[model samples]
Target chain A: MTDVASPHTDPEQKRGLFETLEIDTRLLGMIGAFILICLAFTWYTDGRFLSARNIFNLTIQTVSVAIMATGMVFVIVMRHIDLSVGALLALCSAVMGLLQVRILPQYGIPLGSPLIAPIAMAAGILTGAAVGALNGWLVGYQGVPAFIVTLGGLLIWRNVGWYLTSGQTLGPLDPTFLKFGGSEGTLGVTLSWIIGALAAAAAVWAVWRARQVKERHEFPVKPIGAEVALSVVIAASILGFVYFLNSYLIPDARLKRMFEARGEVMPEGYTEGFGLPISVVVVIVVAIVMTIIALRTRFGRYIFAAGGNPDAAELSGINTRWLTVKVFALMGILCGLSAVIAQARLQNHTNDLGTLDELRVIAAAVIGGTALSGGVGTIYGAILGALIMQSLQSGMAMVGAEAPFQNIVVGVVLALAVWLDIQYRKRTGALK
Target chain B: MTIETKIDPRGTPLVEMRDISISFGGIRAVDHVSIDLFPGEVVGLLGHNGAGKSTLIKCLSGAYHADAGDIFINGEQAVINNPRDARGYNIETIYQTLALADNLDAASNLFLGRELVTPMGFVDDGAMEAETRKIMARLNPNFRKFKVPVAALSGGQRQSVAIARAVYFNARILIMDEPTAALGPHETQMVAELIQELKREGLGIFLIEHDIHAVMKLCDRAVVMKNGARVGTVNVAEVTDDDILGMIILGKKPPQAV
Candidate 1:
């Protein structure tokens, strides 16, 4: 800042060194290819895919996988994985149901009572957090590979969920519980997703602010062009969505009421309000927010630093263990949130709930660009990954593809994503 | 009457490690090594490959805890058990790696873990950039701006950042481990100029180097060590490169070596 001269005699050499080290040029190509694939999917799905309703529907359906994948992205970025999401979700949901069906009844709260459902959801979240803590503590402090610990927890937690409910699906929860996960706002959008989006937006803003600060302070700032471009793309996509959603002739009850107040009859149908499935909004928001945290904060830096070179980070005075523990906890909290959505979507608490969710979530993250060996990922990448999986599944299903065929397609896609990651690593020297 | 401490204000020693000793695996890596550093002066630590110069300096930098001995700051015994402690003592260490993250810029590396955050609770990058500019202006007015990442910085500029990281933290005692190593002649000269600037700031410097020419050219005093033992400390003006080299080879005083 003070002096005009850089210490390096070869400035180009230094820039080239980083260019050869951190990012893969091929990733940009891959992103282009991903966009093409998306366009193809929409094209083949024949207008249904592009329709606001189905796109919204897709968002709702993919919420669980998206949120969990975002969490797993950080875990994987730190060179770890949580195979326990499915089982943990099941176990937590089971715990919530059991507490509602059994304990609330003892307190004179009926099964469908508002208090009962809220308590159950809280219990579910708590259970998930506890399970996550167990994983983090074990991994961070006990020196265990996260893959092994979380996998063990996955099986064990599922067994516990099944056992606690006597292997039965519990249900007919309080109607008000719908507000948490089942209820979309009167505006025709899910409150959960809105809240999730708000949270994510805040995180993104904070990160963006931090980047600006770093730049202004004349710190070793990254190029703002790419970031600004990417941000514009994200903002454009969101704006385009909101704009189109608003443009449609929404049948609002309020508008109807106003018409009726003017002596006109209200229209009949679930039309045109600003409504989204609660689950859809929650997952998208959570995914974006977590991704920002993974990118901007000290916590995020520690994850990548740990992933890139643990010894160096340690020497730099970072508490790597705490970072590990915190990441696991974060994942746990997300899984719990996903549990409520999953349970609400089914409108029941089943012992089988959240089963195989880990597979879908981890697969999505890996496909999005997160490496199992650690230190390379983005939350947005995870979103793209989740969308890719969901699109493939929906497209194949639409074409009458069997479950086996869908699974095989997913497997091939997963393999290709990993291959791309390897090629990226080779180009960047991020991998041996 | 208050003592007011009869210490030379400007000529004060920035860092002093007395009887420093460290052991690893029952082997004494640094044995009873002592060094004194004065502001505006360059002190050289010369030794063989395993001569304990680095280990001794690491103790002061809080990279390694001394099994025995204490480090003093401004004539006060300071306990530097960790790097943070060294940082608190305003003591900075620059290894050959430069410890600069290539992804980060000079300001980011200078601030590193202790970033200048905004009031809103994020890193105030603009302020950091400004601060980096100010520091660079003082150190090298000709230093380039927009070295987006330290990796993009030249060897001299990267060294400047590493040095700036120390100075930014208000370090009075600065340790350089082969600061000019692996640099071209011009790059080395650039570093030499930066060192001079640091000295002008009234900083006490300890340069751990293998080059006797650099030691002969820059140091005010030269301390020689061998096999975890101090050979002798001599005024550089009174010692020759041959004298120091002989001390490094034979582990004795310059006079004895001569």
Candidate 2:
């Protein structure tokens, strides 16, 4: 570390190219873990795990939890636990299902109307926000510990889900409504390629902007070769993902055979690509927006400050109580979004919807580098954490692992990841 | 800097804490302590552990509210219920802990609660960094850790950040708790110089210090407290180190204390 109080006249002041770049070790660790997990699964499954179809499916599978995990990062960063998010998802889904199945039908709204989906989605989000407001009220104004309040919420909301549907599953939603989470309604091949190109451009621009800032400040910067190499690596991964998704053949032979047998002639020159899953698109958008909020917003900074030291933040004139309320509220809205996607993907709303999801969400946030002790986390990191968790589960399932065994392995990995994080922090003297 | 040939005529009192008293649980932490500060004056508050100097200052800084008594600014009663209220009165406190967020870089910590934002409500980090650079350059020319968290900085660098935060916010009345406690001799001299600059700009400062030499060097008046009561307040120019020591250790007021 450079001494801020002393002029740097030492010969060692100039660092190696890589060292000057100063990438976060935690983020690099996550990327490495993700790649290793992918390789292990690919090897174990004899290349099937890395098949274009499976990778596309894996991205979709990671969506719901990934979205919620993004919000959970903020919650944990502010040193608060929200164990009720899973139950909140169930309650939100139940409300949407009930509105679609029982309530809206009586109002002469056609079951097949496209309007029903948006209305039901809005209702579900509002319901989640309401419950979140209640949680915030109890924790902030009533001075109840968040753990106890959310623990009570975890039970109460699940029970509410049960009561809403009388313990029966609800669904067979409108086909249009279901498209959000289905593979058929994706960002098609050309769009996926276009998006990949745009993302690569943005990445390059970000690097260039960072270099300019460093130069303007007269700080040491990475060599141009190193910077270009880093950007190329990022860009290649993104474009490669688009190419892989585009290669996954949809309407496989079996489906085509069935259609032909039904006397439906295939259109001439017709071609289908897997494209990007709509749920994955939703997750990507959520991740990008949340990352911006976390990095560039006043509310984001306040979250970290309040988490770092509530007393200090308070003395600095932040209304920590209101901030707590706002954070929970945001988490609640995210739960609502997760609910919609999960319900669509499952094609039904079970009373047990989102059970044990809180654990997975928390694990993802922690694995992604969100510190349990607070004031340290990032939205992108948490999203990657979710991806890592889902990949492990997906890979293990492909290898014919039992559910019990999978649970144990995931639990160990979560612990091991946190232990690694602690060691890293210790080495860096950033543990405090 | 030219040493003053004689003390300039005292300006109107900028702040007055009249008969302020606060009790925590069953303990009277600060008991009816009255103190006044004038523009461009540095008042040194000296006390042993649990001597109520911090508790009394906390009341004026709005970290704690007084159970009994009143605070007046420029002869007008001021209501200070929280730290926000204190800042509203241009009263800034640099806590002993420095109170910086360890996870955030220097520029972020400097503008934590009161962030500079673009018209779009996004935090203008570039603008804020530019401002921080300008201030750091003026205050601590050697400071170059603007991109790193305060936790990674040296003690003196952290002190500079805390002091810069207080001074940058247009603080007219400053409460600095052990500002130089963690600094080296060079840093201490830098702070001393900073204090003189603030004095020349006509800001009032309350300095809580243990180092008697620092008190003699920086303070115009020194107030000694013991057992939650004021022992005396004396003009530093008229009091010997031994005389102030007697007031602190023996609870004996000097002839002018009345």
Candidate 3:
């Protein structure tokens, strides 16, 4: 009789660094690629690309698409694709823009009123959800393929937004609403430091709690040194990000103008850096929430299960049809949230607001490791994917590349990333 | 020849599907079939391909709704609109295909719809894993690939996962469709032993099989069906292997059964 050995039972075999740390090798590869891209850009642009200001701008720029990409993870994980997110974003922006600029004022609610921003936001999100539900219904109950349904949505919603705004850009939106758009509002140096410290603490606590849970269940725990080292790395990276953002001091002229507007004289050498933009914060919150939803919720589990084997999931008594509706609706709500950030950043709603954004968001999710065939994805991966996509586009722009060339590079990179992922899966025998 | 222990047919049946009928695309896949099972009994359902044995059992397992029928659990009328409703009655099915989510780990597949949740309403993955480990230890101690997706598991191992899922739920009635089809000789023997163990613990099982030898050995009573209707059901002790074979191949009731 021969004894067949299981992979994990090889007690005498030495483990690799990543295995011991229990880090996802894919995630490590992505981070390495991101750093390499940054270094390349910095070298090409003569160090201007790696400046704190550029980094800050990059974070904000990644927000809207990144938010939608998180939702795309769920969509793709369920073996469904959403082609209307960009159009949905434009429609949502139009709804909010109209509410803020024309409708609210017509109803005698002043533009600067505190109620204006919230009202507009609510309407926009509701519109997004409604449209998303319609999409889901057509796909789930009516048996329309997601691709066709969302393709129709793409054309319909974009034109709907155009018609709503009468082909003219609507803007000078509420100042409160505009705050959600990157540079207009930021968490200053002190608050950014505070948030960084809190996040670090939370990260450490999560690790400790996970260890405790494993111990309670009598499961094997990671080496204490590894745990501590991981915690240190997480904390350092978080604080380092805050420090880097804090390095970009607000210009002297902007400070002077701010002081003049407030009816006060500017003090000598008075300067404060924008710690983190509100849009970036929105992306962070969305990413965290989406990750938790994917990892912790029953809805998330069912998505993977159904994607893996639809018949099995159905036999297990999962209401897979309803699940499809809920997933697309969630995607819709994200589009609405994304619209808020996009319009706020642009300070207006234009017909072309989210043009070609759908492709970018899908690319981000795919590049982040969400399998197109379904049943595999990670929220953090999608966010990082968005960051990578944004970096490539912005980097090429900074290096004086033409728009056509930028698109070509991005398209080639996306294909290469997917091919590499397939190769990786094949090597590990993780390919389905 | 198989020896059968006589059962006192005096109590309420554990499950009864009376006059069950189901159609697909206007084709009567299962027609006017009725079967009942008692506690601690193994009822073997035998038939050739397209004999409607699988289809008939699927109705009980909630995979299909009977176009016309009434189901009674413990002599009480039961409404099984779907697999969830069937599970609510403590009925579980180990499908022939194994019906496992290939991408999910064994624990996830085990608790697909009925997940253990924390007070915060999040899926309690660690607890589920602990429970899965405990069950696997009992059912198949050799099974140790708990972390990998079920797709990576061997055929025997996947069968064990499907069985473990059925057994862990404290099911009162089990419907096993070719449970040993994908298993090796040793795994098959293990399953036979498991059926005996489950029988001793008072779980009524509907065993769907094509192997007449296994039916003669493991079943107390064999119900044979052909072309969407029952031929006859006979006690294993009275019906020889040839007699059951006649019922499956010729769709005829043996004189002994009569």
Candidate 4:
């Protein structure tokens, strides 16, 4: 009784008050299971095993998936699929790299060639958007299934990447170009802290605007206990989480120490600054921006509506076809952006770089509770799913597990995530 | 006392269905029928399911054009080539399903097709919320909630959103297909009140109701149909449940009521 009545236990000021009020059993169980698994992992890893640095590594690696999953949330919400992301990424990276070719100075603008790089990146994004449009059009107007169109797109775009790179590697992107990713070094604490603050502000703005509209209309709102407390808890958690990362958002000041031993640098030692990589920053931006788009826009609502019932949306005077096409195109653009991040971080472009990335992205999305049939996903869920996936993979590798074994584990995990999601939907009566 | 008008050449009709016939290939569903609706009046369309009642309404709404009949809206002889065209001609049809996107909230649903836009051309969600507040205020004071997704709303709320969608678009003629079919008694009363409110606004509503009690309670006049033919159009005061029942069974008016 004493334990249960802790001063913090008062529902009014309770942290994570939303979780307790939830009627969805599946969600409750998923959350509970997730907590249990995390605890188990922590216990197994022990004090040294679960350090801040290791957790940070897990987070940084999953950033790309987290970002792609944000866009996937919108697409999945509309009951559509965008399979061209991997290929789109490849194509974008290829173009980005090719534009950096001072080897062909005449066509490559200048050695520091500022205009050419921006144009190339823009061209890559547009190409991705165009492919997405084609996918959307085929599905929306031509009555083709999104799966088939995107699948065909995957092959075509990958081929284009190979053709553009002529089956070769493009490298040494300009330092400024790489800085967008953090390739220059771990981002300054100022940038990380600023980005985190902006995210919190954005979240608060959306919540406030939506609530005001509801209040003006006298709609039923969550009880005040849940509302105000949840807001404070959420805001505080964001602040604290960001502060924790800010304290160590960058790699250790001596991360390069491992690269050197006994007063001699290893053959592959001497990595860049102890700071966070630029790719990490790019991924963070992607996650924040895309999640905002998914949650706040009318376009986002349309995606859910269209996913729930296409015929009904059409009858409601919605240009369902237009929405479908637009989402497909947007998905492609995200993929392209992901590809650019990959290219910059890798410091080189290769057709093979993005292979199987789609599977991982899809797995992360579904694991995050993106319903296969659609109209049920969120950016946070997808990003978390990706983090979980990458964490498991990293943990396995650290335990001396082979890639094949890790692959099997991931496959099983994906299936379980999907099964759990279906169960969750059913309990919530959403499956109906 | 309600104000009403029929000056646009009752023959020309705001909507005309002439010899409009449709068949499912081997069967002649709507053999031959004609109906006309003019401005500022309620027109009830009734019949059993197989009697082609829905088929006829579908033709008018452009869901299905009569395989043989011609549809003209707003006199001047028009062609409702498609549902989009029906909308262009200010003809709106509300189905039993309400045809609403359940995941969207009320304001979004109300302005589903024709959303208000900001100066920069993005969907003006705030303006839409305000406009919805204004419209729903006059019709239903109870409808104040705007942001909760329709999926979480009650059945009556869903219906309200659908109706508001059509009304917000300046639809002059509304063809509601069994709007009250699946509602509970209290909900039916609420909807009936909504209909009266629409009527008070001077909108011509073609309410399709299966329940004779509902039709008598809410409609100013009623039209009965059987076997793809008009049983008759009669004032509510002039008919009873027995009359509508007889019309449904025998395709004829009841003796005393007639």
Candidate 5:
């Protein structure tokens, strides 16, 4: 509504330069934390942590959780929580393994058939979605609290995974499906560059269109200088990311000396560059799509309104209960995707596949600035949160820190990020 | 075009709630109260807190269901099972608390449930913002904070957002539950002018108020209730402020009602 600024002050001039950036301090703080983590780890590991190969590995490690975190952002923003995602992921992948190893083979479908991969993936994703639908129905329609329903689901789904796998590991997956999660399926250097260029162009065009619309409506527009500066930073980041991936050589040149000491000559005609990891590409696609859903769709706005004040939303004629159901269902679908990626990357589905993953997914979302109290979140922020968490885990492992110590450090970081988020909200008076 | 085209030309009352009664936990909140609002009239409901004025209005606004009553819209019986049912008849209510999503910007709050979307089902934010600006320019011209959440707005501005949201959705019968209760004198006057503007455009309004002065200035007629029962309904010109106060405080009916 009305502003405190003087009437003569043009709307565009009301905000200061820093405010024009439209990047809140929470995001800046996350970005700051990311940079600090990278520098510290690089120093501690004598540059091994920041090596292109390890950075690529870290990106790969972040992929599954980042995908799940994107969906978790919506669930949390709608004032609900899902503690069953990790269990659901394990169960879905186990079901896929079951279909591949026992059921499908009994139906006369041979292993490694290209069709087997698609069928297995579909079956796995469907199983997860179906379980999610049940959760939604119980919580949304039966008036059960989400926390209770999903906590129950966490136990039931994990046990179901164990039963499906007969308490044993299953896989050495179809070679075709494995490619989606491995280096052999990556986009080469030239393709990565092309994709980066296209993304940069889209970013610039989006900014330009937004500015045009603001001008047309006589609303406050971010200054042109700020827009250009933002676009340049975006373009530079994309290109720099492509360059970093391209710099890493596949089969790891770092291991060449060890091979020489073993009196083995380097294999001729080995493919050299580690282009973009396919898993990273999957995460990016999911992030982009989920971001659009959160920011552009009517359903997305309803999620925020319902989460912010269910009473007000209902008075405004929203079906808050049904919206909650839909949100959970969407989360279920994302869990399915994460399952496929997880199974492919490991080439196996064990009883422990995706165990404790729900905590990591939730931590990433909260650390990325999504409030646990609801009505606030972003898909990109959650993805960044996932990356930040994985970077810490990978760096600590590279530095030879014990697993227990790594867990303690990660737990502290998650707590600190949330504390910082609360402080930022308080400083800006955005906290209700 | 002027807003006059949207008004019904027939001289019929827009809404009528007859013998409406409801109880909560063995306590009757609204007992056999009947009220009517004609097009182009501002009818003020005057009562002390818990005297059932709000309860009676909530039934009309579809926030509550009446246990023993019939509601007629344009002389036809209507079933209002929920808030959505209320909106289907173009009835909108501005609650005493304003009922806005505090975290969302004014434009988003303005079009919460009934969002205008592109053919692709994406909310058309640009169109919605431009439309919000257009309406606010008419209702409260000083409004310009289209970006910040409504929580950051001043009381009057939040009221303006609530009012604009109600007015924008083609609501023919509007309910205001103490619309200016928390506002300063200047903001109060702004809301008064806005009510008068709506009256001129031929929309029926129910102005619930504790401020007798506000009722005297803005209402064409006053209906006073006490202890869940109607004391009387009188034209503002026919009664002094003291007369309404006596009805509210003493539960005494005027000659006409008796």
Candidate 6:
């Protein structure tokens, strides 16, 4: 028995490259596909597609759907689909827009007041949470199927947003709120580098700390060479991403306009890049937090356990019904956050804001490797999934493809991705 | 193997389900059944497929709420509304289906709802795996695939996981439903040995079984049910195997028991 178990804990055993690197093969495959798509687009556009400016634009464009896609992973991992996120986003956007434009002003708070943004954002998110709780109540406690509940929510919330705005677009929102829209605000080159450095340090420290913990527990630790290589790779990726973003110099015209607005003379050859958009930063922060929640927390464990075998989870004394409510509520809150990014990006709230976003978000989660059958998903996978979906759309549009043709391609790609995932799972014997 | 004849049935039972009845829709799945288990004793529940053995045990395990009657633990009336409540009373159940999450690894499944966490509220996966390794080393020494999901394991391995979960939590009153059904002969023998070890530790066990030979070997008392009602419970020391078989198949109490 000891001999049989030795290979697992022994570092001397022959191992594959993936095993040595400790990287998920599925994630590696997705990254490869993303690079391939980027290269193909770059070739088709004659070197314009991979430009830093376009990459910056791509990151911001992916933010709204990516934020909601993280939540969708949890929902889908529990074998439940949330079709109301896009519609819910519109409703939240409408509420925030109306509050910023009309209600807050009537309450003696001006549009430019700092309180206006937070107040309106809170109200919008609260509204989302409430509606989400209602949806969850219907599904978990009332025993209504999640599909039917969220499907009805789709129609109801979209119209509710329309009724709120009376078919008129509302905007010219608070300036502070608009910063979350991307390109409107940035971390600046220096601050971006500072953050990037800090992130790199954190990544390396995390690896070292994990190894220390494993050693303290007397568990098998990875080889030192492998650990160092992983840390170097992680740190390099962070610093490299910061450098790429920093290379996209701001347009001189926009720089001059900024100097004039600040009532200062523009210096000769004074140039700076938009190192990282605030919206992209939001996505990054969200990705990190959601990953921690998915991997570290007890609530996260229950979500996976319940997803894996609901009966077993129940038998293990998990409150599965309440867990359902919490998951949907979390999804609703994410929709509200996405609404903030979407409305800010557009600089206004249109009645049809976030239209068709639900399909895109779901596709992103599935393509990122979240199994619809439940009990399997990762937060990073969903975000990457969003990036892939956005890249395909942006890449095709750059190449002058027709909108209808682009949709056809996206639809076919979604099917192919799932089919490929199934094949991979079958090959690995992860699926029966 | 020396069987310890130390059971004293006259004392306060470790667990008592008095006149427990539960119905599904219009059907009485478990009708007016009463059974008791003493400390350090094994009570074997024997019945046909629909004879309500599982249903009756489920009530005690808090998987189902009985329509009528009460449960007493250590001579105190107990209120068990759910599995959590049952666990609070130091009651653990190894379900018939093995009730394991197929997608999670063995360690994750072992610590499913009751994870060992670090001081900062994060799940301590290393600690959990270490503890699981120790338990598996004792329970099933051949279990090496602790990193893969339980779905990849063979039936006997999965069964061991279920058994280990029930035993790890210091259960005073344990309920095992067809625990050895999926095991090979060696694993079954291992379970029988484990049962003996647990019994000597003063844990009362309710063993739901279809195998009469297992009952004769492991049980201090055999309780037979027919059509959701108890036929009789007799001391294994006195009742012949044929008498117990008649009670199971014919739903008739033996003359001696009467």
Q: What would the per-residue lDDT of candidate 3 be over residues B9-86, giving only the tens digit for each residue?
A: 558889988888899998888888888899999999999999999999989889899999889999899999899999
Task: Give the Å shift of residue B57 in candidate 3.
Answer: 1.3
lDDT of 6 by residue, A260-321 (tens): 99999889999999998999889999999999999989899889988989999999889999
User: Model 2 off-target regions past 4 Å?
Assistant: A1-14, A212-221, A252-264, B1-9
When candidate 3 is compared with the true two-chain complex, its DockQ is: 0.48
Give TM-scores of chain A for all candidates. Answer: 0.80, 0.93, 0.96, 0.81, 0.92, 0.96
Off by over 4 Å in 3: A1-17, B1-8
TM-score of each: 0.80, 0.92, 0.96, 0.77, 0.91, 0.96
For model 1, what is the error of residue B156's alpha carbon versus the real structure, in angstroms, after optimal superposition? 5.0
Q: Lowest summed-lDDT stretch of 10 residues in model 6 chain B?
A: B1-10
Please identify model 1 stretches exceeding 4 Å from their true place: A1-34, A179-236, A243-274, A291-296, A305-312, A371-375, A402-405, A418-432, B1-12, B133-157, B254-258
Q: For model 6, name the residue pairs that clash.
A: none
After TM-score superposition, the amount by which residue A179's alpha carbon in candidate 6 deviates from its true location, in angstroms, is 0.2
Steric clashes per prediction:
48, 0, 0, 8, 0, 0
Model 6's interface RMSD:
3.6
lDDT of 6 by residue, B82-152 (tens): 99899889999999999999989888888888899999999989999999989989887767776678887
Flag clash pairs in model 2. none
Q: How would you encode candidate 1's per-residue C-alpha lDDT over B113-165 as one tens digit per residue? A: 67666466655556766888787787767666444555545666677777677
Model 2, A331-420: lDDT tens digits are 999999999999998887898888999999999999988898999898888988999999989899999999998989899999998999
User: TM-score of predicted model 2?
Assistant: 0.92
Q: State the displacement of the C-alpha of residue B147, model 3, in Å, after optimal TM-score superposition.
A: 1.8
Q: Model 4 over residues A73-192: C-alpha lDDT tens digits?
A: 788788877777777788877777777763335664754666765766687788878888888899999999888888997898888979977988877676666655533455645675
Instruction: State the lDDT at B82 in candidate 2.
Output: 92
